[model samples]
Target: MIHAATVQACLAFALLACVSVAYGKPTGQASGRNPSKAALDADQQFDKGSGIAIHKLDGAQIENLLTLGKVWGFLKYYDPTVTSGQRQWDYELFRVLPAILEAPDRASANAVLVRWIDGLGPVPRCSPCAQLDRHDLQLHPDLGWIADTRLLGKTLSRKLQRIHGQRRVGTQFYVALAPGVGYPVFKHEPSYDDIHFPDAGFQLLALFRYWNIIEYWYPDRDVIGEDWDKVLAAFIPRLALARDSATYQLQMMALIAEIHDTHANLRSSLDVRPPVGHCHLPVRLRFVQHQAVVTGIDGTPPNTSMLEVGDVIAKLDGRPPPALAREWAPYYAGSNEAVRLRDIATYMTRGPCDEVPLTVRRGDHELRLKVSRVPLPKDYLAMGDYLAIAFHDLPGPAFRLLSPEVAYLKLSAAKASKATEYIKQAAATKGLIIDARNYPSEFMVFALGSLLVDRPTLFARFTVGDLSNPGAFRWAPPLMLEPKAPHYHGRVVILVDEVTQSRAEYTAMAFRAVPGALVVGSTTAGADGSASRVTLPGGLFTIISGVGVFYPDRRPTQRVGIVPDVVVEPTMAAIRDGRDPVLEEALRLILGPTLPISSIEGMYRSQSP
Candidate 1:
């Protein structure tokens, strides 16, 4: 019954189809205003329309996931001023509430929404979440979900037949973030503005998940609604923007910033070398005007000539070294120069650097340096796993034993060789003094508790993320030590100052609750557990805080640092002469009325480089 022209058109289309098939085009690859009939059918079938698509989730899910994302961005990150729990949720609630009510079925989706709003476990919150406690919204007769609202105020038996096939994604995001893996339901509440934010990883996740609901559900509004397309449209372009290492890093930071918790942040790479040479810089640094300046250097080389003892470094590469610290700002983030300098030193070497270059200015003349760098001694390199390494060849230490009886372990945080070799050896002797007055070589903090006992123990527990999927990691106490491999339990004392930070603090804190141990020194720099890097907005980054470490009793240590039984301080003269006042005090405490100063004096006086 078809006309001749129709027949010709059909034949020509068939021929083209054969050619296209010969070229091998995959399904779902072609998508646009115009597409093959088959491709169009597939797109329509998987076309999750608006928020919850009519399409089923399958192969195209990742692409459809582009439907929403909370990528970290500098501009979108709510500032501290705007981030109070109530205000943030208020911004989201007016947008999200209606979505839940208007959901295909609110009753079926109630449990999922409530779970994400659950409060933190141990973190103190004045009140339960405000957003989830709202009562005006209709709940299913069974009081279950917001998305399954059609069942609300209706009997289950009456609705069973019609509601069976309807499926909702549920408020899965919120449920995943809330604490204790339980559903959220207000046992008692009636307030619009009473909600406060949650702490811990689960809480943060809940807050963001709550915001995402408004972002998706409330499509249009004056100040209260959200536009998924607007956010997605804005972000997808940036995601597709030409990728640069710095920009890529920035984008990741932006994603992290969206959570905006002091304890939450991005991570960077840190290289651990073989245990080799010690870090011996012939210079001293001081914090002047909130900037760390080189107050002393051994000699003025061709590139380092412009730098002096009092020179201020304006920019580290293109980033501000001190300013970027706010990103992760851990419990010990800004406690000392040692911590800050360590961050800078590692940041400079993140990428390959045959000859590391730096720019420095003394008064007016600008200068640059190409410093030679080396890895840890090759002999000490031993790989255990991607996450662990043990290096050996480190240079002469910052602290050394002056006396055999007054055993001394100088902690240098050197790569390759473990810096605590002196302490381990001294632990076998009568009295032990640890010097943390210098920088760290490597972040070998896992084995500290292992040296104290011959049985396994819980050294620390790291908690990350918000209340929901808050990740927790435990360090089972090690049962063995290197070298002698038995518990040498003896009189142990540690010395610390501002330079004792990061791994230094970690190593020092490990001694807590151990028998016959004393921390006698000034407060440590307090920058432990966190790893930092430059992230977004050109030189901006998230110094993601580490999960808080805890004692056996599950006491969290974050804002508050480890307290030493006795506090010791140092003098400039003592530093110059390489004598530790803290060590002197520890010796006094351990030696008590028995040992005489003359007995230990000769050993410390015999100096050997």
Candidate 2:
């Protein structure tokens, strides 16, 4: 239990506030250490830990906890007193947890909940509580659980229904949309950075907090590929029984992967996840034709030829890459299978600094070789070249004329302010290749998009959270690109790959809106929309694509991504020969058969990786 004195301090402080609820404060406080210090901590916050402990739970306990989680989350988002930021909801969970945990049966649990709700005082009937307009809504409040009398007794159910009906209006203290972007800004979510490993109560709190955040605020919950409520039930025992910090983190990663979003992952550190090591094989790998193929070699002069560029890495350290990927899939969060495999391939060869055995296939010959792992290059670019795709710092200026006939612009180095200059420079060219093969340095959605069109063009639309009605989302008007002076009248081709994500994907959607613009490349990362940070207990951090991004006609772009008009994946031979097939295809489309691919002048001189 929370040190008695600390619980006393919390209750003491809560009592000083307006007493509306029936229970003056939470009845249950989890057990923890440092009584005197904890008491002082309680005067401020739950700084030490949630004192609750857990062992094995029976079927009945699981069911009871599931219902409790639903009820707690419902109250958090729906009840006016809680939603208005008047209550320390996390502490309140600690207070009520013990009573529900010890309840003998469903009725007993319901009674405990009833008292908790009653103590929050009475709900006043609002004259104009926000109501959902089905026509304009992309998602509606998921409140069917409130009427589940079989789970919540009639009295408790009635109380919940009343709270939902008169939910808080105006700006909610918990969440708000960004000033103009419309992505959710989770306010006042403390990281609880002091706790290296949280106790059972805080673990349960993490689960409850994350599950509810997605349940109510995630715009694409309908497409999460599984019943989210069931997910909550399944993970409750897993998190509660986690024996150590590593186990807890693994469970958390698995939970995050269930959301099927590339943007959602444990961002605090990569060391926690698989391929955990300080050194890696001195070669870059990319998934080509469903196989891990060497794309680029790195390090000093050696840059090793032991594994040739086109060599297919069938096995690493005697383990097949695919098998390893399968083992790590649950922890690798991604939007779709393509991007999932793309990410897995990036780190499959990373491990200890030792001679790693590898089975390689060169044409028909199968060869075995032991490659030495080296510390990543001291320079960021060299290390990036050795491992994952370069996030920024593409080789040349953002825009330049590849030739009089072809204009090249890579968004990785492009500046939005130079959009006019870029357009003017490209005006005389027959075609412009806007490379979006990496994350853009700036948001070029309107800056460059405007210079490509002759009139207003509809590109994308969005779904934003409804402040008054939590868990509900409405569609915003379609975004448009207004024409700017000196518009480029040339044909357009966009280059993209798995490295293209979020803003890059959004920029592609905007550029593709122009007439005759052709997108040529393999599937993209698929995770669009602005990312919102989610901080959990135990100092863990993650993100969710808060807003739903869609094409103008309401075609979803979350997991499906921006499908290219011309699909062109680089061939193994092309990688071995230092060629970019995707860029070649763009050149082919623009230059036609009249100009030889080799004669494109400066096109391949400073080709970007």
Candidate 3:
């Protein structure tokens, strides 16, 4: 016969015994010290005593944790019930990593994950949350651990339901609880090079880290032209097979290229093969009217007379221009076909030898020529001598009046502080030509844009991710530039080409928004966004477009550059004759009859001598 008092006393003793074992102290002394501090100290002691190294893991173990980590990061952001409006959620991956790495099999690894989730208290519920739509959801159905009800417990399923519900009903995939709070966003600055890959464990860590960052935060996933989930599935085996440092670096480059972004490229320390570090053919090629034409040749004595201006390159070693471009497309990072071909033309000339065989078409004659490849000059000018001849005679001032009714501002040399002064000077002019053929010296989007408008105009918008809500993107408020007093209501002409990228493209967009502003010249590089640098295993560094930029109506500007109102590409004759065709067109639109054809011809002829 058991008595109630005896049973109660026995239960109390058992509870005290459990507390002593867990806390490493007796019941009386456990209350004297801070409970949290004691618990932390005990955890550290246990970790130190354990034979397992938390930072290291085998190939199998790495793959498992990578799978679990992806799911863990996703739920932390997308599941509103899990976050409960908290600005920051504790990831604590290192705390449980040892146990996870030590697990012998998939079942055992899952057990470790279950224990980690249980430690995080009950998940709150939101009754009004909507269900998830198919298009908005991505699930790893192959991973049974994620779907196992017993492992997740009842609370996790309910929390997942709330996340799905919100996505379905409100079309909200993720929401930023606060600005700059959420996932660890990688910075795009170059801080380190030669990241030595010490071991396989460290290499795998880099792979997992990079994969998760792109999976959750990449804003242009939909425009990437491939199923991102499938890419993750395919790269698993490939990354795991990287056996050496060089191979690992190459693998990282291959993976970065999967994003299809021009900004994605290994840092300069790791030489990108096939596209760099080779002797050039000493000729500049441009895609003109869908044909590859030699626009200029190197004036070096060894390369002189081998190739001439206006020669059409029909074949390289035996392959057509288009086929050759396709062969090099994987190695040449670019956002669009135009930009890709532009870069490929430069790379096609590179080789180990100082000469390459080519089939060229010169008027009616088709002849085989061996073009000498010379080392690029140290003070190489991108514009070459022919184009430089046209600008040589222009006034040395960065901003000057082409005529009384027309003003020209060279964006590459113009100062931002002088933007207002330039605008004031050009206010009465009939036309303003803003030359952006080269990279801008400084950002002048707002400074120059404000002077061209009469009222506040929305020029651009951006898409940013919610840290707590992975894969959820929402448009930030439109960026508007208010007009400064004495706004120039004159026609604006902006010039652009391959060199006009990033800030230059952004500047063009800003100026293009001005009433009657016309963008001239050829297509731009089409890559425009804030670059974010990502460091991978083995000291490999690369970059990606961190944010999505779009027009006011949500038209994408990533792979597609800002279109020009009047397309005026320079011809081979124009380059040889030292004439500025694009500039001539801009003047035609502005000065019309005031500048006669004979006057323009004489102006170009005078620069010849």
User: Who wins the TM-score comparison?
Assistant: 2
Candidate 3's error at 375, in angstroms? 3.2
Q: Name the better of 2 and 3 by TM-score.
A: 2
Residue-pair clashes per candidate: 60, 15, 8
Q: What are the Cα lDDT values of the candidates?
A: 0.35, 0.76, 0.58
The alpha-carbon lDDT assigned to residue 170 of candidate 2 equals: 61
Q: Per-residue CA lDDT of candidate 3, range 1-609, in tens? A: 223233223322322221122222322122222123222334333221222233334666755565555655555455553434322122244556567667886667766766666666544454555432334232212223344555454544444444444532222222222222111234221122343443344444455556666775677767777766556655655565566666666666666667777655554322444544446677778766666778766665655746777887898767777777776576555677766677566556656556667899877889898777777554222322112211212335578776678888877678867888998999889999998776565667766777788987777766666442455556665676677766887899988776566666777887888887888887776767555545543434555566677887788887778888888776756655546787787788877847786666554344332
Query: 1-609, model 1: which lDDT tens digit per residue?
Result: 223233223222221221122222211122122222332224332122112212122322222223212311100122111122222222233233333333344343333233222321111232222122123211111112223334222332223212222212221111121121111211111111112211111122222332343232211111222243344433333333313433333433344333222222232311222111323223444443455455444444643433455555555444554664443333112333333343333232223424445565555766675444434323211211111111111125544555555666555543324434544555546766656555444433333444554444334443322221111122322212222254556776777655554455656776554566788766554434433121222222223232234455555444344556787644433433445456566777766757675554445555433
Model 2 agreement with the true structure over 1-609: per-residue lDDT tens digits: 223233223323221111111111211121122223232235455667777888877777777888889888888777888776767777788888888789888899899999999999988877677666677798888888889888787999999888877865664766777655567766656566666563888888889989989988899897899899899999999998888888888888889889999877765545667877767887778888878998767756755648777989999999888888899999888988878887787777778878888899998999999888877544321222112554322367788777788888998788878889888889899999999888676667667887889988888788889888878889887777778788899999988888777777878888999999999998888888767767777766667887898998999999988899999877887777767778777888998857675674337655553
Determine which window of 10 residues in candidate 1 has minimal summed lDDT.
384-393
Query: Sort by TM-score, best first: what order?
Result: 2, 3, 1
Question: What local lDDT does model 2 show for residue 158?
Answer: 92
- CA error at residue 502 for candidate 1, angstroms: 3.5
